[model samples]
Target: MSLPFSPQSSLHQRLRVGLGTMLVPLIMLAGGALISFEGAVGSFEQQDSISRQALFPLAEVEGEILELTSVATHAQPTNTMTLQNYRRKQLVIKSQLALLSDYFQGQPTKFNSVQEIRRQWLEIARLCEQIFEATEPEQLANAKVQLSQRLQGILKNTQELNYRLIAFQNEANFDKARAVREKVRYLVAFISLLALALALLFAFYLSRSITDPLQTLAKGVEKLGQGELHHRITLETQDEFNHLAETFNLMANQLEQSQQDLYRLATLDGLTEVYNRREFNRWLLVEIERSQRGEHPVSLIMVDIDHFKRLNDTYGHQAGDLALCEVAQLLQREVRPGDIVCRYGGEEFGVILPKATSADSWVIAERIRLAIAEKSVVLPSQQHIDMTASLGVATYPDHADCKERLVKQADQALYTAKYQGRNRVHSAEVNECNHQINKLQRMLVKQGT
Candidate 1:
């Protein structure tokens, strides 16, 4: 039976294949989105932690300075204790300023957050320097007032700056996180729809492919059995099922060619390229049958190169092979299309021309003889040798009935041609050739001698 639908509908198959390709990438995109979301959240937390850490060093220095000022006002302080307290406050402020500078160094833009922090840190460092240079109690008191005022100013400025920076960074993080979440949501929905669509397309496409080629193959096989050898399967897809269809088509083609080759090889003579003896026998029998039915004339010709043995001995065996090939060409060229030529054996050639009288066969046989006489076989060494052949012809349904008897009569005529003179045509009677075969042959013989 024929296929319900053609196999060349590739759109559905392509959609199925495309779906398989997209599946893995969709999974990877989803996983990558999840990782990005986690990284954004982690970054927000770290930023908050770092901003808080930036404040700690300043706060610690201010607390120590306040303690030292209170002790100078209320407690009985030894000189060494006062000086020691003063030294400790100076060292702490310097250390805090160094930490603040380190924090500002890593920021993208050192404009607001970094510049304000640095300015405040510089004022604190100047105050600590003034305290270190103080010589009297009143001088120390004045230095403490300057240090306290500078510290309070630094704290206020840094606090406001830090607050604004942290707020801006958090807003950016929130926006980015929201964008990533929306992308994930959209991607998930799209993938769900895509997966469903892909599954449906794949199932339909695969099911159709499975049945269509089998149906085509079945129809093609039936046609092949009936000897309609031109039947072929057409497949459009590059997938496995299509590959199988192509293979089936190729097998059918080879099978058809194999049958033709076997028929030819069985009927053809391998060396001379004429019909083999079996084919010659069959053709002669058919001609005889036709003659018996319609009373049509048929003729047979048997040809052999004269002194074939002496020729092969004088020239080499390879030259004898060339002689056969050249003779086959001459036969095909000289005989009519209806004529059948066969290589009878080593140095013998045969011909069957239907509807030809003995007279017509004689003319063709003489033509072949003259054609061979006119041409010489040339070798690669600039050596050329002339050759000649004798022909015998017999009329069919007149002289004989069976194919074997027709051939025998032709052979007898050929023997007569050889006996009377080696290079001439003899059919029913000897016919004198006006050409000189001996002139060329005599030259060749001299060269050989």
Candidate 2:
């Protein structure tokens, strides 16, 4: 029998545990990744945008300077319209640079670079104003020469800063993004593999828990089906499968008991509680076949209750039944363990001895006769009557070879014993069979009976 299941031992509980074990790590991994990306990666995204934005202002300043230099170089030397355009463009460029300077206040390096560019811009504007005022070719050429020299230093500084900002964005965003993706891959792979392994482990557990018990039960049922009435099952799982195993074993026990009951009903004599006539004939055949091998001879003693018809007429059928039961009990008690006693018919019995000779048969038959004569049966009216039986002994390979001949010879000897005196042992192997009766009587008396 199995113990009852605790909550933890329940099937549903086990399933829940398996699922939780498989999913918990993945869940934690997902949650951790989400939190890390939200805080750290969000910060990186904002920094990446700010770095790209920083370049926009610098690029605008460079474009404005280039446009002003172009207008100055292409202008007619004596044209007032060109000078007006240069003055308006110069004011706009200075205003834009001031905003760019404020944007770089957090970095001293970039702020210093913007301050240098501002100084250079003021120098370039003064030379351009000189070129616009000059009418002589020598004066114009001298002012343009100074403007070109200042533009070279400021343009180089701006382009170099722009290259540095591009390199910073690549380092800050692309490299970190690759590292984050690799970390995610490792986490996902680890969680997926762990969950798969756990799933496989639990699958094996469930299979054994489920299929092992089922196989045991199936084997038990098969044995029972094959008429093995003593087969049983054992299981120790603290779950419904164990309970089912216990139930199946219980059912097998009941089925075995029922089969025994059926066998008793079919093969036992109801009145005498001995084997019935059908079993007697079947066993006789079996014994005869064994004796045919010639190594060990078998014997049979056919017994009939003397004066049974007269007893039934005198008392009642119940008295006759009691006498039969008493005689059967006495025969069973006197016989050896290997001997078989059967109610051959109404008031008649057969004893099969597997390895007994004719002499042994005669002795056992006489003992049975003496035991029957001493036994007393009480009628329903409370009257006691002494009973006696006539037995005929026959041995295989001497009196008969087959079951039919053995039983026929024993029956003939029985008829002869009854005809002679009705309470004597007769043997088919002997002509008189009178010598052993008195000898067995003396032997029984000397046994402290």
TM-score on alpha carbons, each prediction:
0.49, 0.67
Please provide, for model 1 over 1-449, each residue's C-alpha lDDT reduced to its tens digit, 9 standing for 90 to 100.
Answer: 22322454454555556456557556756766676678667766776676666657656655664565564443222446655766677678677757766776766553455566557656655655555666676876776677677667766665665566567667866876787678667766676667666666665765666666668778877988898777787767555557766887788889879987887799887777788878888888998888756768789999898777877898888787778888888999999987888888888888989999888998999899999999787765668878899988888655565578788879998898999887888875422241134334434765796
- Measured on C-alpha atoms, candidate 1 has an lDDT of 0.72
Give lDDT tens digits, candidate 2, residues 1-449. Answer: 22112322756666666666667667767876786577557767787778756788778878877777777786665787887888787888788778778978988988888888899889988888788778898888888877787777778887887887788778877777877777777766776677667767776775665677789888988997898879888876667767777888899889888988999989999888899999999998888777655558899999999999999998878888899999999999999998999999999999999999999989999998998898899776778999888999888756764689789889999999999999999998543344355345535865767
Model number with the top TM-score: 2
The segments of candidate 1 whose C-alpha lies over 4 angstroms from its true place after superposition are: 1-210, 226-231, 236-241, 429-449
User: What is the C-alpha local distance difference test score of each model?
Assistant: 0.72, 0.81
- The candidate maximizing lDDT is 2
Q: Model 1 misses residue 182 by how many Å?
A: 41
